[model samples]
Target: MSLKAQLQDEQKAAMRAKDKQRLGTLRMLMAAVKQREVDERIELDDEQVLAIIVKQVKQRKDAAEQFIAAERQDLADVELAEITVLEEFLPKPLSEEEISELISAAISQSGAAGMQDMGKVMGVLKPQVQGRADMGAISAAVRKQLA
Candidate 1:
């Protein structure tokens, strides 16, 4: 099933099960997806939906970190719980070895010989790694390889 369909199914199930937290998170995600679609005037494919989910997860993580920094453990816990719910829709994370292999392939494919060609390498890598790996970590790995 498409990720969006899967999310809708899960949302229904959550409602039936009276899972308030999961239901709320799923509703929030659906709202975000709907907002983007309305803004762009195009139906988002699975990849686009995954991108939104990834962005949401990242936002929650950042918020959780800030909450922790402010010594607001309760708020941080809520953000962390939302992340857990959101991550259910994401693809399994790539392993370190898999990520290394992908980076090597991308660098070679792009002929990225130095830092100047970092964009080329990332351009090759982004589609393959999106939602499966952290882009920041992938960029750092690419830099280390090129350096």
Candidate 2:
């Protein structure tokens, strides 16, 4: 089934189970997906949906960090729960070693001699590793490799 279909099924299950928190999160996700499709006039494949989920997960992680720093454990826990739900839809992530290897390959392929060529290296890496790794971390690794 497509992502849309799967989401609908899960939404129904959440509703039946009276899982208000889970249902609310899933509805928000579905709305985001629908908004993208409606605005862009393009259907989202699994990869596209995964990309959205990854973005949402990253935002939750960032929010959780802020909440923790502010001593708001309740809010932080909620964000973490949402992250767990979002991650369930993502493909298995790459290990740190695997990410470094891919970055090494991208650097070599792009002949990125230094930070000047960082954009070029990233251009190559984005499509290959999108939704598979923490891009901020990958970027740091790329910068380190070039420097």
Candidate 3:
């Protein structure tokens, strides 16, 4: 089944199980997905949905950080919980060794000779790593390799 279908199934389960938090989070997710589809006037595929999910996860993390800094642990915990639910739908995170290998391959494929070619390498790496690895970590790896 597709990601959208999976989300629908989870939504039903959440409803049946009386999982208020899960249901609310899933509904918010569906809203975001539907919003994008409506705005763009096209149905989203798994890849597009994944992009939306990634964006939502990032927003949650940022909110959690802000909440923590403000000494509101309760709000921060909620954001963290939402992140856990959102991540369940994402692909398995890439291990360090796998990321390193991909970076090396990207660098070589892009013929990146130094820092000047960082963009080219990153351009090649982004699509392969999207939703799988943190772009910040990937950038650091690419920088280290170039150095």
Top-TM-score candidate index: 1
Separate clash counts for every candidate? 0, 0, 0
Q: Give per-residue CA lDDT, model 3, range 41-65, as digits (tens).
A: 9999998999889999999999999
Query: Which ten-residue region of model 1 has the weakest summed lDDT?
Result: 104-113
Top candidate when judged by lDDT against the true structure: 1
**What ranges in model 3 sit over 4 Å off?**
none
lDDT of each: 0.96, 0.91, 0.95
Runs in model 1 with CA error above 4 Å?
Answer: none
lDDT of 1 by residue, 56-137 (tens): 9999999999999999999999999999999988989999999999999998899888999999999999999999999999
lDDT of candidate 1 at residue 49, scale 0 to 100? 99
TM-score of each: 0.98, 0.89, 0.95
Runs with alpha carbons beyond 4 Å of true place in candidate 2 = none
lDDT of 2: 0.91
TM-score of 1: 0.98
What TM-score, to 2 decimals, does candidate 3 have?
A: 0.95
lDDT of 1 at 132: 94
Clashing pairs in 3: none
lDDT of 2 at 138: 91
